[model samples]
Target: MLRPALLALFLTGATAPAFAQPPTETVPLLREIKQWVIGCDNLRNCHALSAPSGVDEEDYSSLTLHLWHQAGPQGYLRLRFDHRGEDVDLSTLLLDGKPLGLELTQDLHIELDDQGGDPEVQSFGGIEDAAARRWLQRLRNGQRLQLPGDEAAHVSLSGLSASLLLMDAVQGRLDNVTALSRPGKGAASEVAPRAPAPVLRKFTAAAPLTAEEQAGLVAAALQAVKPEEGEPEATVGALTAQQAMTVTRYDCAAYNCEFDVSSRERQAPYKETPMDLQPLPLEDAALQGSVGYDEASGTLSYFYKQRGIGDCGGGASWVFDGKRFQLSEFHRMPRCTGVGYGDWPALWTTVPAP
Candidate 1:
């Protein structure tokens, strides 16, 4: 779920409807354009356009979108739009692999089909007609669109009028979006926050966690819990040697899938250097429950909480999808183990960027 505090961000802004601006006289002379060549799925005139069969517009999540049109007989126009609460100011637009110079006095947020395909290019009388045709035509193709990225492109005058007029000629408001409906609020909610990934080891030559340091870690973990609820408190088993420890193999279907989680007790710190004892405890921080993971999208997430001396507590985690096997998350607080918290000098990690 999205953080409740961020709800305010999704609320539409109170900006007044833009006033109609007269097209600059020079615009009538420009011919470049910017647009997102959408797949002709659910389009009223889908059968009219010459396209490969079977590559239906219905199945795709990505498309090539750009904005850079050049100056021509028509005046260059820049296009800008608000995207996910951010402004996309583009100087150029790329439509169907072609480029064009653009200039936008006001923001123009519109959606362009990112579905992979041979971008159709024909001709355009100028930039003004191109923009109008580019955006207005979406409705006829059975889709209402908002400005997407700032990418721009050059428009073929012949295709510009045909496509734009086709869009303007027909109108149908999409209510139930299955395969061809325009994206809506429900679409936004489907977005998921990415889980943490396995990260590079950061501890090189660091002092082991002392009794006090272990306690500090427990404190930090508890504090990180949001809303002050579901606090994963430290437990004695977490600091005991006989705490529950399981090592199961996982078949992750997606990236960032955690493959394994390992935990064991240690008596003394390892004699080897910190780097040599990676994904293990080498310090004097007695801890139980060390999280472990195999594959990571990026940063590895590791945790250790100790309740007392000669005891350590921690766990490792990785991203795992149910493609092959799945690793479950710890739903309960960890117990203490007899393992000395020392030798805890190392943890699962990956290199980090600046």
Candidate 2:
């Protein structure tokens, strides 16, 4: 059974756009290219980021570059940089210790934002397609991409050409003028079209569960996981003294309270099988995470943390229809490169069904 606090933590409404129905080819691809990591979602939207040489280093010292591109022929490329550490003149970026002579303000039309009230941590974005391609072309043959001034931070260009080549192939941009790695006179029309995001219908008319109904479902879920006769009960807040001693070995306050109940499974009352309790089905069979249900919105959610740092994880949510729980959203981030949870790529997405 979920504690009131735990229920409140997990059952809160998700403001992110709710999506539904898994795409026929929703499996995303992730690859590591020598200090750089790249991933593409089902929609063919691709993201590549530079990782620290020391994988365990949490602070992204001077600058981290991220590249994003949409899947279709009309899709454009964009570049972003997150800067930390000491102040440096980003306008004078260097490739192989030589200045590229590119005008950052005019070419990229960059925008800067100070994140988390940290004056030292600034983010820059909005690199134009033409300028981005020019920069990529110049950097691909270089060994290091360095920021000018004291504390000259740099990212290795090793495997960059291969990474861009793979992106070109994945988006079917090879031999086309739009190809970032291998451009030719071929027209953009030859590139593959972007795949449509899957749609899921939410039963908005479904009535909210009453207090009695919620309590009954919770009881049923607890009973489902109850131990056999003479065995120790695994139920929360009702543990025996010995069981509590074993369970208290880990400090929930220091780490995360969600870890205590994340491994436990819960059942919901399915209208089709009112006589029996049924576990809600997830689009991905591997997501064995903490489960939560909202009585108000009739949404069931599962969240799995790759580690206690919360830097990497995946989550999915479903809105309950009259008959069953319909998948509304699914997202995952395979790399723990200091990116936030909201920044994860979406494998399955949906809009409310009309």
Candidate 3:
């Protein structure tokens, strides 16, 4: 199934410092334009990618086109091509089966990297405003984009125009000179300024839990979460009764499990509240993902994998500022186009509060 990226903000408590505020238009937006998907983050940075042709194909061999632009007068447009087979030769790139007779390296610098894990995968792309404009103009009306040698590795251009237009609108570049779809004589100064990323105050008071304390906490957490009535107790080897209980209650056999502090607050002396009062946010709150928590840093992370291969997903992390959990990082990749987790476009970022 094709997974559409869901957008939600988890606000921190009142104790968080007011170091910086997001843009007035802080709402994140995601839209599916035919075979393409576009998303704009809280800071107004927009990203669009070509969707894979088949959702059920397991090989994960597909050609993906990525376009990104930051929101501001000085922001430069960037483009990249990702392929799962091998490195792409830009000199042989084709638009509707016709060659683009232009010197690509003069305006853009392309770098090929192994992307670290799979030796068969490679990506290259970096083009500023002028090069980006020229490429966009050539591709705006095309039917298909063909890479060298690989007949199956081609991106559909059905919704390319509409996706670019939506990106321009989201970043307030419509009809302006910097617009990707609708360019005009309007000065670059007419574009909106980039919004400041929010700042988070870190808390360092958390102490690492001893082995005994950690085991006790895990038991207490499992007991607090009551198992559903009529549900048979799960059986697993090499696990204690408490561990089995945790597995059954959380369905950890199928999905991965980790600790989260948000579900249960710890008062002084390490007292835990009942599960009914504070259910796991991964299952109860609007956020949807498998959660993991680090006791040493007081950081809770949530990641939802769109598929088992883990090529696409949305994830966020928050830090506990001695009182509440403040969002520290957020990113999403709506399309399963072979983009790596580190390359996902960030929708929200934060720095340490002064």
Q: Best by lDDT, which number?
A: 3
Ranking by lDDT: 3, 2, 1
Candidate lDDT scores, in order, read: 0.25, 0.55, 0.59
Q: Tell me, what's the RMSD of every candidate?
A: 22.0, 10.2, 8.2
lDDT of 3 by residue, 163-274 (tens): 8888777766777787888887767777766666677776564444445545555555555555434332211111111211122235343343323332332222234333
- Judging by lDDT, tell me the better candidate of 1 and 3: 3
**TM-score, cand. 2:** 0.69
Please give, for residues 1-354, the per-residue lDDT of candidate 1 as tens digits: 111222122121222122122112210111111222211111121111111112233321121121222111111222222122232333344434333235332224443423331233111121343463344334233321222342221122223334322221221211111112232222211221111323323312223335643454344333433432232433111212221122222232222222232332322221111111222222222112343323223112344454433233444333322111111111111222122222121122222321
State how far residue 168 of model 1 sits from its true place (Å): 23
lDDT of 2 by residue, 1-354 (tens): 112342232222222122121112223666778777776765666777776545545324356677776666667787777666555556777777777675543464334432333455556666668888877877788887777663436677777888888787777777778888888786776677666664555554434344544454345444444333332222222111111100111222333332212112112341112211123223344224454545456555667677766656677777655445566766666666555555465555445665
lDDT of 2 at 159: 78
Report the number of the highest-TM-score candidate: 3
lDDT of 3: 0.59
**Model 3, total clashes:** 0
Clashes of 2: 3
